[model samples]
Target chain A: MSGAVEIAGVGLHRFGRFDGTSVVDLGLVAVRAALADAGLRRGGFQAAYCGTVYSGVAAGHKVLTALGLTGVPIVNVEAGCASGAAALDLGVGAIRSGRYDCVLVFGMEKMPAGIIRSSFFEPWREEAGLAVTPAYFALRAQRLMRESGVTREMLADVSVKNHRNGVHNPDAMFRKEFSVEQVLSSALVCDPLTLFMMCSPNEGAAAVVLRRGGRGGVEIAASALRSHLPGSVLGEHTPLSGLIDDTAPPPTSLAARAAFEEAGLGPGDLDLCEVQDTDSARELNSYEELGLCGVGEAGPYYAAGHTQMGGALPVNASGGLLSKGEPLGASALGGIVELYRQLRGEAGARQVDGARVGLAHTVGRGANASVVILKR
Target chain B: MSASRPVRDGLFRDCGDGTARLLGARCADCARYHFPRAEVCPYCSCDSCSAADLGPRGRLWLYTAVLRPPPGYRGVVPFGFGVVDLEEGVRIVARLTEGDPARLRSGQPMLLVVEHLHDDDGTRVETYAFAAAEEG
Candidate 1:
């Protein structure tokens, strides 16, 4: 906590699909906006970090080259969906280490249409149909329902709440709200999960400028990232990695603990949160993993209306990925951008009133989880 | 019927009768089990592993019916996938014979069977799947 690093500025390109926009264009817009917001001219930042999955090699360099901002150290990082957060962690670490007084961190992605095809699995596994993401989600959903009494209605409620919040977020992709009936009745992608319940793997870019020893701006209290431990078959880690051992904690829980310890604050100290809602069940599961609610109690906690807007601690006030669509690399950083705006009192209609402390969580395909805490 | 064979070699094998057993590896150092076989134990991080048959019976841990075929998948649409906890203390993700949710339940006994997946260039490809065991 001694070497305080603050989110000097944050920016984003609207989260949605643009047929003709190149990935470089998406990233250029966000990076330029961030530089302007930070009040930094050329030569202000000493280094840059870019996170992306499918944007190809030298993505960050391409963006900087386009803007004539190349020359400083530009590094690219990827951890599946947590790509942005991973890059942010590196930038925060650099600033904390006094390697750079100021740095740029950004992420962008143009995800392929249809089900996400990860080369993470072997071709034989994909051919056998065991690598489908929705199927994995459904398997987890079914287990959650049995163990936690989470009904399909409760799942629909999460969609309803997040989508309703999305209506106020102009930057989000799907701004329309849907009722519980509509959510549940939407085309079934997998058993116990409808298409509406899943976040679209679309396109977007998010950027954050971090500076050492800043005041007034949102301070990055903690940035912790953890990878999955071996032997957690039932856990949220990638399927087929290990055997069943529920005793092992998922990466989210590990990252949350590390983040809380680093920040010297717990979940109760946060005024609001932006958690991974890759799917409705995932959001609820994150509640338990992040310690926002006790294990197996997320169902009741959510049912009590504690996470909705205007509730005690509103979650996903930026409409979350469920509405914004996941651009993978930008996904985690998008949460940080939302938290930054909320803490700065600039989040228009979806603002969480009197917000001071906020936490953002993102788990990626490598089974990596990142937790970032921000405070005013 | 065209010639059918296991989709991948060394994963599971037909017992020459009607039964199929998954070929797995067990760690000599930690005794942890791994499906699809592993040369090194991920749990113990030791190379002291030996091939073993992961018995035919396991309990269904969870399941889901995929309404659409995954990318690059040539199998039938709406196929069933599940996590099964083997009697050998290993958990594995596999294709299930039953695709309908109503016909699948957690904790039900499952038996390994080699079944047809799809036709690939005039040849029927077979893969290992778990079928619900009849109850008394």
Candidate 2:
């Protein structure tokens, strides 16, 4: 295990469509802002990591070149939607290994308009019409609903809650709230999942600066990543290949367990959290996987104000990806940025009270789940 | 007119006696099964995988309908699909022949069919899928 690392700065190019901006431009915007936020001079970093998908080769080098922050060993990472968290994990590893004191990590994406294209499926599967991205989310949603008693109304409530939070987050894409009726009445993308319940693939970027032994910022308590186990199915966007491993633990649970163990804390130790709300149902399922509530308890737990603002363990206080359209690679980092701000008491309007320790989680298409714990 | 072909080779085979079966790989070392075919055992990493016949029946484990067509998919709008928990213990994602997505339920019996997926050139590319079994 490596030593500790601290986030010195965090920045984001607001989550939404940027019609004329290239992915590199979005990345540079976030990177420069993060450097400025950290009060660090350019070209002073030992290395850099860029997380993205569909952004061609050497994405990190391209971004650095635009910023004139070159000459560093820049590496690009792709882990479906968990790309950003994976990059942050790499940065933390570098700092703890005593190889680099300060490192830059940024994630950006500019998905073509429409349903996000996923190359994770085989050609035959694609041809069978089993490759639509949201279709998998809906399948998982139905399974979670049947198993957990999570109602369609509860799924809509997730949209309502997150969108309400989005109104306060100027950086969020959709800053408007809707009633449960409105969300439920929205166009049905798939059974039990509505248009308003799922996030759109748009464009955005978020960047973080990590420095070992840094003072006065959030400490990285733990960063853990786990791939899909042989048999478990939740959070897996990969095509079903063979016999299901019904006995293995879900990747999120495994990642969360490892993170909490490394942090020497439990779910109750968290003050706030930002989870992968790729859809409302996903957030509900994550509640169980992250151990925020006992299995089959998310519906009641969320209804009782446990996840709302000013309530215990408020989740998605930055409106989540549901309100902040997912830009794939940048989605995880966006959640991290929200938590980082909440930990520092810097989040305006939507800040969690007395927030000290926070968790940010994301699960990608490749069945990779990441959990990061931060402490003030 | 052109003859139909399986989307990929080795998915299913015609027994030349008016009967067909889905092709799966069974591990000789561990007795586990895999859908489609496996070159090696995914569980024990052993190279003792061999072809086995999986019948055309299963139970619906989970399902969903795509209201909009995905890129490169030539299927009609509002198509349904799900995982069929085969009797052989392997679950596979397949398009449902059921037109209405609302009526499909979990644990319902399902039957497999090889149907035209799309047309590339003059060939009717056929693929395997599962549908709700007809009530007797």
Candidate 3:
């Protein structure tokens, strides 16, 4: 856009089950850490944007009020799992429009343990067993397998790689690595997708401080958000909308194209990526959607080890949602925080060496897809 | 058997001949079909849509089985569901009578059927589903 916006600081509350911890408290930890990292005192930032899905009304105001950082504009945003990125999109736009110099952006969630539920589907759909999230994933996975020849083993391999990478991330919820066999053998949540292949809905928080001018920090190269086009049907994130149109481009492709164009960079120039792995199949689907690989080529691309930690164009070096667990609101921002560390060469074990550019993507509720690019 | 009723009115109609047809709307402006019957056409933004019956028998686009019950769902666990392409070119998501992945394949001919979903109170709540055409 207009002026360069840099991530001044980034922070996270370890993702996992924090039983008895209030969602507000979980957000407080991440916000305080982010402010302290940015060397900003209370009320130093001009505004705050909070992203959440289940934290209830005025969730951002609640977090800022607890820190006595009220009186400034505090807006809460929701766009399914892309909530945090949506908030960042707003904050970045505000700064580019010369509305504010410095702003605080954070996302937090204490998920109601188990499957994620959304009001996007009609009551009848849920009653007819047509709205189950896992079932949707499985359906997509089955189609992917049919079209792209992606096998169940390839899906399991995705889980294994992410879990292996998650082993090095202290902020990740499940840090232990699992073998492909284990992932395949784990309880089947739905046909073709096993328990370990799916990302758990859990609790966590992540935050970032954004400033107008770059101070040798990671610059926000581009931020783009896109919604599903009508008649995409299976091509979109949400279920039961429109008719079958295989030609319809998914929201991920739309958002990725916009972000790449804004940054004046293509997929070939990226050093790494952090994409939505809400399920293992989603990761593979993202590879094709992000233009990282040709259509129907993700299976062979992963088989070539091009997405592994030390491999070229590593994806999900932060373990993705697979190991980090999806704390809806915080999921997208958490990826940003990871990219911030990698771009700054601060990511210890999971760091992609000499990484200068990175991309973070998240698709929420099958409707909103966001792509954010960062550069050193 | 207890009294039975459709899960929600206007979704599908069961003919006395053990046949069923999905109810939808066809946009008079763009001639596009919408499942569950929308009052307006999403593509053309035209409100001249009229009720249309999507004939039974289409190709199964995709299918899956839910191993666990979704929250607030009163249906049986591990139910089969799929996206079916109707003969009218409109795609619809509905439950399938088949849950076994071994028995299901993409592009298989499917026919609409009205079946029992679950027992709500004392009545057998029914809903629309798709079954293999050969199974019919």
Tell me the interface RMSD of every candidate, in Å: 1.6, 2.0, 1.7
User: In candidate 3, which residue pairs clash?
Assistant: A237-A366, A238-A366
Worst 10 residues of 2 chain B by lDDT: B12-21
Q: How would you encode candidate 1's per-residue C-alpha lDDT over B3-60 as one tens digit per residue?
A: 8767888889888676699889999999888877889887778998999998688888
State the C-alpha lDDT per candidate. Answer: 0.88, 0.85, 0.88
Tens-place lDDT per residue, model 2, A18-72, is 8888999999888998999888756578999889998889987898997788988
* lDDT for position A149 in model 1: 66
Backbone clash pairs in model 3 (N, Cα, C under 3 Å; residues 3+ apart or in different chains), count:
2
lDDT of 1: 0.88
Off by more than 4 A, model 1: A234-237
The digit string of per-residue lDDT tens for model 1 on A100-184 reads 8999999999987668988887898788877788888887788779877689999998998999999999889999999999999
lDDT of 3 at A243: 69
Per-residue alpha-carbon lDDT of candidate 3 for residues A16-129, written as tens digits (9 for 90 to 100): 999889999999999999999999856589988999999999988988888999998999999998999999999999898899999999999988777766777788877877
Given candidate 2, what's the lDDT at residue A145? Answer: 77
Query: Over 4 Å off in model 3, which ranges?
Result: A235-237
| Superposition error at A256 for model 1 (Å) | 0.2
